[model samples]
Target: MVYLAEFVGTAILTLLGCGVVAGVALARSKALAGGWIVVTFGWGMAVTMAVYVAGTTSGAHINPAVTLGLASIGEFDWALVPGYIGAQLVGAFFGACLVYLAYLSHWKITEDPDAKLSVFSTIPAVRNPVANLTTEIIGTAMLLLGILGIGANSGAVSAGQADLANLFTNGLAPLLIGLLVFAIGLSLGGPTGYAINPARDLGPRVAHALLPIAGKGPSDWGYSWIPIVGPVIGGVLGAWIWNLTGFGS
Candidate 1:
């Protein structure tokens, strides 16, 4: 069930992520010439929906770094980490594949190399590995920290019980999580615009390389390690900070 949830969640994420890119970057579209704002909010909504779907069973880490970090900080069950990461990556890979299929026709129409690349994956504004890596790290750290707080602090209680008067319960965790992502986009995301999820970055990146899109540029392999490494380090750091503050205990 977890695997299936991740699979569907990630497919939706890439569909939206890449779909919006196709809309904005491809020729003859209403969203063409749109800017970063579209991408940022699009991703935010993607995360929200993904979480809404997968939050209960798998916790919807969806990023390996997040699972590893939470485990390291003793907030998650270590026994489940590997399976979770594997599910996330598989889900992401399938998602990217779907994006490729969905946008294949658009690829033929788009002539711009960079824009074509944008339709499927991320690229740094500047090619400095260190700076881009740091950006990803900071962005991921912010995200994880807020998630930890939300998880630790949130709860629900039924205030009434009746046939028609029964209360529905909800937690603030999702809202806080969404706001944290929003803040990350607004603040620390400017550098690389926050490819904070390792699977989110790497899976579609692999699809971009594998897919036969015309005029596609290099997959940016030289800097690929940044997204993977940065998020892991940053997630651990965020979890560490949360633990230090006694939030993870």
Candidate 2:
């Protein structure tokens, strides 16, 4: 059930996240009225709602990065890592598929292959691999730190100060985490679109490659490694840093 929860949660997350991109970037879509602000908030709210849906059953680690980060820090059982990540990946793939079906009519009309691809995965604003990787690493590290900080000492999880520790259980944690994502998007999304979660990027990117969208371009496989590798490293790095801080202690 935990794995299933993660699957459902991540699917919802990616569905909304990609849906917003489709709305804004697709030809003649109503969301064309939107811009970067809409995209950022859309992702943030996606995270929030997904968390609410799966928080009780699975802690809602909708992103593989979150699951790995917690496991690396010994906060989660390593035995469960594979299942959680697998579920997230499959969920993300399905979510992107849903976005495709929703925008079935717009793909052929939208001539830019890049724009079509962007609906599914991240693309670096600049084409420098080193710089792009660095951006993803930094963004994901911040994400892990922010997520940990939000639930630190939460009364729902541990014995601690009653006032603040309840964030996880009290329901405000999701909104704060959502804000964290929004902040990251506004501040760090320029370089690589902040593929802070491996499942979020890789699964959808794979979908982009496999799906039969009209006039679609290549999936840019050349740049795909950074999002996966960077976030994994960043998740571990952030977990180690947070543990060193001893905030929960």
Candidate 3:
């Protein structure tokens, strides 16, 4: 059931995250060219909503990077890592499929394969592998760092700081985490659109290849490893640093 929660949560995450890209990038869409601010906010809100949906059941580790990070730090069970990641990937795939279905007519009319692709996956603005990988690494590192930090503080409600901890407890933690992602997008997303989660990028890219979308183009497998590898590396790094600091203890 917890695994199912992971699946549903990830599905919601990609559905709204990709939906925003479709809304902003696809030709003739009302929000076409809505710009980065809208995209960032939409994705942030998507995370918040998904967390609200699944946080109780699965802790809302919708991203594989996050699941792996927590497990690597001994904060989550190694036995459950594979199950969590599988659920997240499958959920993300279905979410991207939902996005495709939602904008069924936009594909052919959009005319730009690149624009269509962006709806399913991240694309580097400059297309430099080294730089793009670095950016993703930094972005995901910040994500895990912020997440663990928030988790650390969620205990404040029991630490004689109930009023001060209200923002991190009950239901507010999700919103703060969402804002963290938004800040990441605004600050570090330009380089590679911030593919900070392996499942978020891979599942949707795979869906793009498999789905019968008009002129969806190549899934760009060559660059896929960066988002997957960089996030894993960065996530582990962040978790280790947090563990070493023992802030949550």
Candidate 4:
């Protein structure tokens, strides 16, 4: 059940998140060129909605980085990590495919191949491998840190403290997480497009390569490893740092 929740949550996340990118970047859409702010808000809302739908069952760890981070911090079982990540990857792939279906006709009209690819995966503004990797690491580290903080706060509430527990419960954590994502996108997203989750990038990139979209350019496989590796490393580091703080206990 948990694995299924993760899969569905991640699929929804990718669907709406990438859907916004397609809406803005694809030709013949009313929101064409809706700009970065729109993309950021759309992704944030996607996270919020997905979490609302799946948080109770799976804690809404829709991203592999989040699953790994929680495990590293001893908040999640290491045994379940692989299944969670696998589900997230599968979900993201289907979600990207849905985006392709949603904008089936727009691909041919969109002249820029990079734009089409951008709807599925991120592309760096300046392609410096080291710098791009660093940016992704930093963004993901911040994400994990914020998530741990939210979880810690929720766990800190005493059993008898109903009011305090309610502050963290009943969907507050998910909402804050969405806002945190929005903030990250606004401030830290320019470099490497803030791919803080590995599954979020790789799964969709794979879909981009497989799907027959008109004028779709190369999947940019060379740059793919950075998003995957950097976020995993960052998630581990962030969780380790949070564990050291001992906030949740």
**How high is the CA lDDT of each candidate model?**
0.75, 0.90, 0.92, 0.91
Candidate 1 on 1-249: residue-level lDDT in tens?
876776667666667766777778888777888877776777777777777777776777877888888999787898987778777877787787776776667777777887877666667777788888888888888888888776655433334653221121124455556567767877877777577888877888888888777778898787778889999999998888888887555
User: Candidate 3 lDDT, tens digit per residue, 90-181?
Assistant: 99999999999999988989989999999999998998888898898889889999999887788665546446565555478999899999
Two-way lDDT contest, 1 vs 3, winner: 3
Model 3: residues with Cα > 4 Å off, grouped in runs = 158-167
Order of all candidates by TM-score, from best down to worst? Answer: 3, 4, 2, 1
Q: Candidate 1: where are CA atoms >4 Å away?
A: 156-172
> Which one is best on lDDT?
3
Candidate 4: tens digits of C-alpha lDDT, residues 20-119: 9999999989999999999999999999988998999998899988889889868899999999999999999999999999999899999999999999
lDDT of 1: 0.75
Query: Candidate 4 local accuracy as lDDT?
Result: 0.91
* Winner on lDDT (3 vs 4): 3
Model 4 TM-score?
0.95
lDDT of 2 at 174: 86
Better of 1 and 4 by lDDT: 4
Q: List clash counts for every candidate, in order.
A: 0, 2, 0, 0
Cα-based TM-score, every candidate: 0.88, 0.94, 0.96, 0.95
Residue ranges of candidate 4 with Cα displaced over 4 Å: 155-164
Instruction: Please report how far candidate 1 places residue 29 from its true position, in Å.
Output: 2.4
Q: What is the lDDT of residue 171 in candidate 2?
A: 74
The 10-residue segment with the lowest total lDDT in model 1: 162-171
Question: Pairs clashing in candidate 1?
Answer: none
Instruction: Arrange candidates, best lDDT first.
Output: 3, 4, 2, 1
- Clashing residue pairs in candidate 2 are 154-165, 155-165
